[model samples]
Target: MKMAGKMDEEIDLGLAEELGVEYEPYKMSDDEVIEALRQINKEVPWEIPVSKELLPYLRPTILCEAHHPEIREEALRIVEGAETSIDAAMMIFYYMISRIKYAMEPPKTSPDALRTRKGNCFTKAGLQIALLRSVGIPGRYSFDKTLLKVIKIVVPREIFEKMPGKFTIHQSADAYHIERRKWIQCDTTFDEGLMPFPYNWNGKTDLLLLCPWWRLGHVGKSPYFPVNELLGRFKQRGFTKDFCAREIDPFTEHLRTLSIQELCKHYKRTLGRRDADSFAHILYFHFVGHFRDVHYNPLFRYDTNLEDLSDLQESGLRIFEPKYSVEKFEEWSVSGIPFEVE
Candidate 1:
């Protein structure tokens, strides 16, 4: 007899064959996918009712908690109040990106996500979908591979020799199908400023590396090893808890051996070291580049004609224009996610 709960193992193979890939792509026909997911849910070993397992992975923690009714209400209110197409689109996008914190951290527990105001891209996308759907707007989530290209004027040839590939970041964009217009792409995570395009770097090429940013639960098994494992590796690298919080390390081996004692020592030492600030600045810059590589590189090209808020205003929709600057635009920190004009 086939072992109980073995259907999941077989489902993977079946899905792979259907998609013609090595792994399931998370794109499934609506009904078929739902039924297959139900079967997979039944196979889970957790004591929590399998029905609860169907909840979206990135849903807001406040929604899950008993006391935080305001979050859901506020989200619904914003959606209900949207008057024009632009307002609805902007409000949804703004709410999605602002609620989630940007971090390199792995998936969070439901409680943790509820307590903290930040999360990785996956969580942000999921929450956006849920909030949109809750308000009766038709929203679906999907992932695509994005190529990030960075152009530097005078980098050493040695750097190119060391690494060369299109850096790929997995991003999630949502679409709303209005009666007149077919589906249009609305990016929720980063500011939708002028969508960056591949042509922006024309004639100047320095380096390209494609790192995979797998959308959570969409791609095959995650490459994200646990934090504890990373802590252990940090110790091996001569970095101790005194250097940083064990929980903050993203590399698996370092997280594994991280200890509170080491952290205390590192914290104390970091207090007086003037270099600490500089070190942090350098680290932030490096991580920012990595984040850009994974999140912003493969940019969506928007209509250049729709460049200014005046266009929307001329179209008779209320538009909120925040102060704009070149630095902010370059960093993709344009306006907060767009929402319906209030």
Candidate 2:
């Protein structure tokens, strides 16, 4: 089976090279190579089949947008600046968390939603990979499933016994591993001083239920997934869905109508106390908080140990510093916003 897998990979690479797909030929292990190929294959449009000559360029375009001169230059700068493992890790984290802003309202693409900073986990991961690649580093995005169980509130034991079903939510975190290097887990959308260590988990990990949003449906169920389909459905009904979708213009207008405090209040009411707390932790740690039903899981939880940066550094892991100086961002303070819904 291993030999066959190797043969299959060689065939794919040969085909990709023949098609002129611009890709980095990294000397990775077979497993790493296969995984990278899988990611590339999954992301590119296979329907509009390209000539073997075109495959090389296809990857560079899809992966790095190398054609964009400015992006290319910035990516190179990031790569050039990394002098150590800590520097590299911090550079990637700071760039994604501080530079890429989380949209007040969802936008279609990371590049398009240019706030002071903006991106989802995917976009942030892409940005980090692009920067890493530009500097001659090999990195790939990875994900894993984690088990989470909801905590019981101050209810009588008898009352709790009457509740139906197990409480749990599956959440995803994106990470990139360098060849012979450590893997860094990043929640770009999370804020500083708000998360725990080993940023990504591989097995049955326990998480804290900080926000109701974390308890929502699975990943693709969020507005970020099938955004257009959901928005179209909303539009057909005169744009009346209570939950926000990716209608940038309308979403921006909606944001404008609510103060930061009002927005927090609305979120609290929608998510409830425990869930809201978890959401706040996400905001404080990852910086990429967004509203999604999947994030609203009753079982959403986080490890308090992961919340400390000092602990992470002591464990020989590097944490990224915030991109923006705290003073600069504090001007738009949403700190006073209550964690629970009104």
Candidate 3:
């Protein structure tokens, strides 16, 4: 039975079978992704629907909420072990960069990211933020629209084709440098093996720094950033109050019991009836990377370039090398059943 949110006719079955991830490929443009959010602005209730069968494990993790005491202290200890302040910050960054593999794990708290070492950019950044703040390293959200192509290194091509070529709203974290008194954009999104690849990041430049100067999601016009006006009226407020970690913890054990295939089947069916707006939100925040594209927020995006930060190597920044190697690339992708293409 097809659910209300029909898989766009473009779903590629053979490719899905080949990739071992079940998704109906329907080609959508940037506009469609943008429009999906509009439903959120209007009078529709914003929520991720959970089926009765999976209700025990369907609680969503609040990605924006920060500062878990125990987790922060543990991260602080790791930072304290480092020789210098910058070294400490980079140590935190390295742990976050090294630990996570971009995938479809439900958004979890900072402690969860460290404990599990698997999540998309949002959860990974939560760990980074928690660790940085514990050691007095200032950090904030730096959301931007990024090309989906950049993710090709990690995502298989056939699955990648289903999504828009560009994600107009992608995110990473920005951390302040205490000694130099500059905020460095430490984009910690790419996975373990793919970390060093040029598509993911280079040792130098802001190419991978994800950050923001002020509270993002504020409304302002931008010829370059398309969704400026829609930002203010569209995104709901006080939504985070409902996304607490403690509230979600009850569902964790139950969620762990399901196979990835079982979980995805539930996600597809429950979300099938969702209107485009909630659908987009689910696709980004809940299902994969948090790629919400609220229009007004982009104006606050701090401009960054691929400037080399090699001079800051003294800050403990260095190239990434994966400790464990994958024997088969295809196996690596399938092992993590729920992840995005870009």
Candidate 4:
């Protein structure tokens, strides 16, 4: 797959040239890119038709490096036994989420996220898109304005306090399902351990409910990775690594005080019944069963030595909180009036 001519200035110039595609190092300004995204959002149909038009979605970009040898090889392994595009897409989505643990301040690119095995919504979406595209499945990044209530639930109060009252950029991914002949949206932000039992995607309908937030609107879709947009919007408003490190202990402590019943209600109201019950179990395991930290799920992180209750208490809870912070947000950024919606 070749990088689209329009995207030449946006992608890695050296890589594009190495692949025998036309190349330019600097083409579009950040402003130009943003305007182009606005146009792309306006022009592209949500139900993207299957055609050569999807070529851009499949091509490698700086952020979504589908052409990377490692990414391509991993994608092949993940979908080795898949019989159809839908199955491959599903396998890729699950594999991406399973590899990357959900966290507040994640890596910006797919390769970094894959290396660290930790990321937030945007990074997860980016990695998933890269993986899908690596296997010849056309994929794109999605952007949206979503409520802070979803974030407030997972993070510590101190971090949440610095955040906007509502409406921050929420990201997800879309993979073109060959059988359905359309793009299927999948929010693989939360991994299996953090998710409920019944949550799934069939590659026909949107799998957006995996997240705890309701979508508000921003750049609804993009043919390429939207990581730069996320950085531009959130960077000035972001907190420092020191701030996140100081807040990690408080966040970890606060997890213990979280009311199971209240969490269940929140999950049920936002995510659905299955998530509610599953989250409750996770909390139950931590608090009552004496698991060290609710966040440390061995399945995703590859942590072999889970300390026993007595050993855990002595060593202290070790939550792998991301050191950086993207928590800064302002209400006025999204709407002139403060967001009052629950």
Clashes of each: 43, 68, 14, 0
Full ranking by TM-score: 4, 3, 2, 1
The number of the candidate with the highest lDDT is: 4
Residue 205 miss distance in model 2 (angstroms): 13
- Compared with the true structure, the alpha-carbon lDDT of candidate 1 equals 0.32
C-alpha lDDT score of every prediction, in listed order: 0.32, 0.34, 0.38, 0.53
lDDT for 131 (candidate 4): 82
- For model 3, residues 1-342, the per-residue Cα lDDT tens digits are 111122113223343233232222223343442343243223222221223322211111133222345665566566654544455655665566555655533344455566666655655665666565444444554555444444333333444465443433455666655456555666677543332111222112343422222123422211111111212211221112123223332343344344433433333343232321232232122111111222111110112232433432333322222221111111122222223322
- Deviating ranges (above 4 Å) for candidate 4: 1-51, 210-213, 240-342
User: Candidates sorted by lDDT, descending order?
Assistant: 4, 3, 2, 1
Displacement of residue 304 (Cα, Å) in model 3 is 32
Each candidate's TM vs. the true structure? 0.35, 0.40, 0.41, 0.59
For 1-342, candidate 2 gives per-residue lDDT tens digits of 111112112213333333222334333343443444455333322221222322231232233332234444565455354444334544555555445643322212223322224443344444554454333343333332222222222222333354454543222223223323343444444322222111222111222223444344433211012223323432433323122233332443343355444544544444354554554443334332211222211111122332233543454322243232222122232322122333
Task: Give me the runs in candidate 3 sitting further than 4 Å from their true place.
Answer: 1-66, 196-342
Q: Write the per-residue lDDT of candidate 4 for residues 1-342, one digit (tens) a residue.
A: 121222423544343333222322323343443443344333322322234566667666656666666776777788876767777887776676566667666235566667767667776887898887766677887766666656665576566777755667677888888656788888787765444222345455666642333556445577665434444444444533334436553553344343333333444655455444443333223222222335322232222344433333333322232221111011111111222223
Scanning candidate 2 in windows of ten residues, the lowest lDDT window is 1-10
